[model samples]
Target: LGYANKTQLESLVRYDLSPVLTNPGLIPLLEKEAAKQKKRVKITLKCETGTHRQGLLLEEIPEYTTLLKKTSFLTLEGLSTHFANIEDTSDHSYARKQITLFKEFLHRFEKAGLPPQRNHIACSAATILFPDTHYQMVRTGISSYGYWSSKETYLSFRAHTSKELNLEPVLTWKTRIGQIKDVGPDAYIGYGCTYRTNQPTRLAILPVGYYDGFDRKLSNSGHVLIHGKRAPVRGRVCMNMIIVDITHIPGCRLNDEVILLGRSGDERLTADDMASLAGTINYEVLSRINPLIPRRIVP
Candidate 1:
């Protein structure tokens, strides 16, 4: 209700009623309105499949199922859960359990004659790995932007089937070199003097840093593409700048395009690559980008 505007509110009302009054805390207020209007209204209970970062637990499934069944005001429109790591075939225990619990949920609801029209359990990964679990429509996010469910998952799927649809990355992340300098051999670069060159070097400073969500942990370990070649990031990224060893790339100058998280000519830096360096994932790399940076949507 807080985030939903008039259009969304009306849309919710048109599709289902219980969602409007499922909270026991809101029951009294809803009842008062119903009393005043002399009508009865049904509601639907909405549950998070699981925390995005955390894997879904089978133990928690029954509690939510019971909650939905017990709510008098809520008319069950659907029962659903998420398979966070279904794409990762290396481990099947987690994905298998989630699927088992969802099947149990479907059985119980069907026996109760309240089987949900939408029994969604598959995300993009699940859709690719477990097609049979698609009881209803799939809820896709990353793939909608033309990215794979995950790198590991994509490889597995490709090995299994050659008839997959081609997907293209839709976003480009680029920035210009803010400054340039030539440093003598053994000169330290950036904060904490984390980088020391053995030979004379030319460095280009980029106006992006941890404060800009460039990730401080990437210092000295990450690479950015410039002039169609990979350049190592030097030292620690500061609030508004990063230093890169551009000595190998001749004719590099201030304001030249530096590919921090995108393709530059033939060289490319993917979100997954960045996340791997940061001990995270591709989702974190893209989502963690600060909102202050201007984003231009391309056709």
Candidate 2:
């Protein structure tokens, strides 16, 4: 609702894109736009279960519902809430309480005699961890990219259930080796001269760096796959380039495929691997990839 300007509100009315109502203040604006377009706008109320992010409180439901009742073109399509802690830990006590509160919110809507069609609360973690959270529909993400919500979520699932979800990575961040050069023994590589060769080394300069979300911390620590071989990153990661020691991978030339995060034969560089090196999470590594980078959908 924060980004819902006049143009966006009109777009909602013009298109059948169901939107979530986080704040009741935006209700009138949406209603006004819907009235102008003579369109039935589907709205899902995001209730404050426990996350305390963007959601309406229980006490505030009455006025919001009443206001919705006044808006003839506005239809309450769903009642949803986000889990506060479902993936980070093996414990789901807080998430259970959130589910309870969400149920109360659903009952509140039902008592008001305006039951929503789509009663959903499950995010990627919630959908994976708790089955009961799956009401009318499920919103599965990360898993769609063939990755687990988290290691904790995976452990919790394995501890409680026997089902094994065979999740193979579907994403592959690829770049071409922009340039390759040979460095004599003890020669420095890249900025700050962080890496010096012990012997003659062949380097593959990749067109990516921290600016490309190839984290700066990966300098001299991370490895990329080239010619199905592990090539160690050399020196400090630059704004738009990183030098990798590719001497071991023979017969590699300029524009050869470089795997920033993916597999090459038996070698794989995953977002999880990168995160471990960067002292962050896989989600951050995946999400921080520069949006301007062109993505190719492999069939």
Candidate 3:
């Protein structure tokens, strides 16, 4: 369930019992020991639901539901499923079908006379879109991280609710300028020399580049903030650096803080802006950040 695996759950259950079992054949040994002691062992199963990324198929779900019914486990605490797409309002037919199927399975479960204590089917998007689907608890992801599934959903929720929730962004980025140089009119900049100086230009080079998850496709199209003002990215974003025209901003220097993705003073470079330049989404922009870079959390 909810992106969990057998190995992980098994570890949690086996931790206490693992050490005391003398026989290497532990399952039999533990059962025999339990029989001697007149105690029983409990087992839990995690079933998959129909999620976009990972889950059982809708067609295959009934079989899983049937399996759950037949199995006589010591503890059967819950049944669950996930919605495929909750952000898309233009078409919710898929999500609606999934919800319907889950409801059908729950009805079957009840007919089997083995209703569970928990029956949940609502993630961040579904929870917002269909609160009635929340039988017990909602499993959230992106929304917990201060972003809605999409702009349409967020706007709709805000319009109806008439109140803003206190959600803060949890990530920031900054890098030092790698180098700085000046070029006269007609001078070419970067690979393919795609950009020629319209006028004499002073440029600052930043060490962050495509390899570091800055999109190479951005090229001359992206924007960066320098000296508290916006500067156009020049030429191609190289393997480990990008050049920006800083002639307009006075007092540009080496080792000045280069904000690849974050705010500086009143200027801000959002993940959405990065996505726009890269022809991607905000999720991709933030997740692509290389793990090798140090991350520090500030209150």
Best-fitting candidate, scored by TM-score: 2
As for candidate 3, its clashing pairs are none
Worst 10 residues of 1 by lDDT: 1-10
> Which scores better on lDDT, 2 or 3?
2
Which one is best on lDDT? 2
My TM-score estimates for the predictions, one after another, are: 0.76, 0.95, 0.74
Residue pairs clashing in model 1 are 17-42, 17-43, 18-42, 18-43, 18-44, 19-43, 19-44
Location of the lowest summed lDDT over 10 successive residues in candidate 2: 1-10
Per-residue alpha-carbon lDDT of candidate 2 for residues 67-126, written as tens digits (9 for 90 to 100): 998888899999887777788899889888988898899888889888877988887877
**lDDT per residue as tens, model 3, 1-299:** 43333334344344422221111223343444444455444422223444545444435545544544443322345666656666756366777877787776666656666565666778777777677788877877667766666676676577667666655555667887779898999999999999999899998999888888888988999988876788889999998889999898888788888777666779887777888778887778777888888888787
Candidate 2 accuracy as TM-score: 0.95
- Model 1 spans with C-alpha error above 4 angstroms: 1-75, 91-94
Whole-model lDDT, model 2: 0.87
